[model samples]
Target: MTDLHAPAHPGASGTPVPAVPEQPGTAGTPGTPARDAVPAEKTGEPKRNRRRVRIDHLRHVVVEVREHAGYRTVVRHAAYTAGGARLLTRRAWDSRTTARHERMMRAAEAAGNEELVRQWEQRAYAYRFARHRRRVELLQMAINAPKAIGYATATGVGTLLILGFLITLGTGDTSDLLTPIEAVVDFVGWVSFLASVIWEPALYSLPLIALGAAWTVGRRQHTAPAWALPADAEDRDVVPDEGAIIKALSNLGIAPLNKAIKDGWQPRWVSPTTRSGPGWHTQLQLPMGVTVEMVNGKKKVLAHNLLRKPVEVWPTEPPKLPGTLDLWVADQGSLSGPTPPWPLLTEGTVDYFKGVPVAVSQRGEPIMGKLMAANWMVGGIMGSGKSSLVIALLLGAILDPLVDVEAYVMAYNVDYDPLKPRLRALVKGDEDEQIEAAVHALRRLRDEVTERGKLLEELGGDNTKLTRELAQKDPRMRPKVVVFDECHELFMHKEHGKEAAELAVKVMKKARKTGITLVWVTVSPTADSIPRDVTRNTSHRVAFAVGDHVANDGLLGSGKHKAGVTATTLIPGEDVGTAVTVGFTNKPFEVIRSHYVAREAEKGVDEVTPVVKRALKAYKVGDVWEVPETAAADVLTDVAAVLGDEPRMLTQEVLHRLAERNPSAYLEWGPTDLKAALEPYGAEQYKSGGKSMVSRTRIQEAILDRLAEADEDEGDPEI
Candidate 1:
């Protein structure tokens, strides 16, 4: 009784392969004709026999195991083995799990010595269509490039239509001598003939234009500038103009991005949320997309002459969360000089970019990103606005993720108190803690310098730059900065003073080019404050408001005195918080204005401070203070917090009420401590001493109940 029933396999002949046992249950007998067991029609037709199509006990169990682990990976391997077409797709690219499944299936096949080909075929059912879809998407980007040429024809045909309409308006004499209109029309016809002839010569030139365009695109790597809407910018239409283009271009500092925008290319606006706190901004995202290409005749896309670049307009600007800037920039203030008819610096990133417009070129090169670090340091100081000057320097160093750089703070008697809130020790908003942290940070930097020198010696390297160079050639090394703030404060302190001087000397004299740039900020140019050795070899010097000729002499010496800049004029008698910056190649200029970031913006506020405080403490306890590569930005943000303003943590009303009697006492309180003390109470806070306070939600409700007995009178936001 040859009742033949067996599993089908493409690998063997047109016969059912033998089925052997691998799992608990076994199916039809081996050597049976699998098709005969099912039906004759099903074996020849495309559709499989319905009975076989249905998963049996073994097939069903295999699927269940795969789902519990990872189904995608299993599917990927099945497809890889079944490849008559390109099998792996974008989704399947990460199918390591599927690959594992395939391996497992192979092992089972070899161990049992059973038919494996049929199982592989059954597992591939899900992926046949999915792989096709991804391939189509990849082809579209290139397919659309040729369509850009169509834009030129519309302009040309429209111009021709106008000319033809005008020609119809003229009346001409048909017989004998020509009338005036006839003569004019004849002249126009001849001009058209000439234009046609000239166009032939340019046909040759057209190819050259294409070659140039290709060359431009090839040399310029595709990096677009990040766009930011101002805090107050609304849904009002932003007319796409050269100015806006230039401003956009300025951000990249590398490519002419504005040109790309102007030439009608589409732009990609990323989510603007920072890497660390992506969830911070819950606001709706801006909707925008930009694309550009030149479509030739017949609506074919032209590669060289890109006709249209699309840009999608966003509904709203992305909100800048606190401590976000530190992630983008490297060190602050490189080319920080002033220029202009207004109080502007010659070049700092902030000073020059505060109000200037920017955009990408058709080729996407930025016009201004290069200007921030222009002439190195000597050129950026003068034009950089007072508040933005530091921002300018820092923006270049800190914002550039690709470059390896860091900044040191040597601030003394300066207005850079906005940086305290983010310092781990000062997060509680303690004033003394803020000061101690600053001092502690300086000491740490000095120690870092000593360690760096030793490390370099051990490696037979002299500087950080050289160390980085060698490390790149090898491995096992990191690029770091020993930063200093209010370094002039070093002169005031007794124990750390000499150490600060020694550190400054070591940095300026030997480590300047070793990737170390001394950021020496001071109120005076007095020779006594800054060492002559520092001034002599030091290539960059930034001068702010100071007193008398001594200040001027301490900087440019008597050389700048004849230039009409004196200490008295630099700082008016009563007013403070102003200064002048001198750089390498930039002329001395004034930095009069800059946007001061709110304290909360620099320091992590209520939304995340509690979490940060716990994390900072956890790092201390677990001895896991090392910065992760991905988390390095947060540590750098801590650096910016140290550079930013004092946290105005508490509400303004409470501080005002607390200080109503002894105004001086509240005024003198370090902004760091003042903010933390009032956080639970709730209040408006500011860096420049205009502190405020408000009652907490719970406390305010209680106060409302006792309003008749209360001493004060200002109401809450709603109440």
Candidate 2:
């Protein structure tokens, strides 16, 4: 009997055939065939006594196909269950079989065996397709299982409820979705009848919804005042996220951070906070073997990655945790706000013992330094507010009665012109005579340091250092502060360079005990311009925007840049008056913006001039001395006296005679010094008798020329 209940296999068109009914007692089961059974082959020959037997009830079958090489073989199997029949496995005979076949395939491919490559590719595709089909069947079973269905349904419902509640709360709506009582009442009212008729609950509840919304709006307005709301509600406060910052630091390719992260280490991020004004502050606990220096070295790259402008990176202190870095990111490219005005010194009693306010820190706290017993070095690139910082310090010093101010402005800037009357010595211009005068003043200060040291030693009570009590007892021991603006000019001078540098180094090292403060301001902070002897001994250092880290470290102490206090990050012109101050008492390193003193407009004086003048008048009585206004006339008269009764004299003879006339001023005068003094007056030095000699007639003519120019200047009317 032919069985008709056999399970169908796929036909040539890739479609399943209809199942046939099975015969009783002819196969292993109802729908499967016997495991050893094989299908009859169709032949073109006559058959003898052929029985049309139908096989059935096959539970599983494995078929193996082998190539002639005996090494390449494939095994395929199929299994059937109540769900349906599926391919159970399709695999190589052995693991090495595929590898060997791949090697042959590569050889064929390299030899351009397109036909062989295609045959192998088709075989590989068939095997992968069978495996993928099995995987998909298993995935489908898992997805459609009862547990998965129940879990997914619960998750979806919970998510929807949460979203609805959040939306209702955020919108401040008292709608049916959020209010249970209102929802029940609406459900039971005539609106329910309308909803049943219209087949839309939302449409029927429109009137109730409108009233609830109106009530919510009115209640909110009544409870919350307009003034309580933020002025700019739409403004975004874009605080930096810690996760984003770590990602940025990782992207910077820093070795320490990358290696730590690669080694499965994670940094602990602290909550970010707003800085006082222009920036944000955050901290990170770095992984072991990583350091703050490692992070600080890549500050610029980190700033680039974080999309912020100029980050300040430093190690954490106070609590002083190792491997901790504190990062400050500016809100914009430049620090916000204008420079604060110079504070008036008139309200309180002036105390030279304690410092005065010269600048403001980034936190807006006043930055004061003791100018009485400390030497100061101010260095920066040009136009970086070195002059302004120096002026602020000078204004602070001059306001005190105990401070005797002297300034040598080698640049001849008119900013210090108003201070001339109060200055013990004022030397201006970059000429040779001005340089000589600066050298002379430095030498005089060096001698005074010795004299004051002796005085302090003699007046020693508990301390040999000059105290306010000692200064009060002896008026001559008043604190002397000398400012050398553009001091590089004096240090780099051809003739007086060596002597000037030596004298400056001496004053900076030994003068602090004697109550003499030397404020040296220079644009160039290189070793050649300002020696290490002077830079290292100076008690206070302020650095403005410089060219590079080398200059920054030079101005601030060595290793300061590596330790993460750097001024090189400051912009040149935009960050004017902003500097890093070191050696201050309150803070080891602080960023300060010096008080700005505006330039005089016509006769209008600076904002600080009036206050300084008043302070000087009240406290600086009998201390201020007027410098001789006729320096040129006095020099010419001295020259005439030196060349008495002779048509001309040797330069040496003139110097000797001038030294005799004004020994205090000309005691150290040389030929070069004499020439520098008289050069502005057009005095001529000529060679006579193989010796350098000055002509008396030329000196007289020079004096007459100066008188004539003075007459011409007086003849012109004031514009």
lDDT of 2 by residue, 48-143 (tens): 212323311221121011211221211111001210111111123433235434654564465355665665665555556666898899999887
* Predicted structure with the largest lDDT when compared to the true one: 2
Candidate 2 local accuracy as lDDT? 0.66
How many residue pairs in model 2 have overlapping backbones? 12
Estimate every model's Cα lDDT from 0 to 1: 0.35, 0.66
Candidate 1 residue-wise lDDT at 12: 14
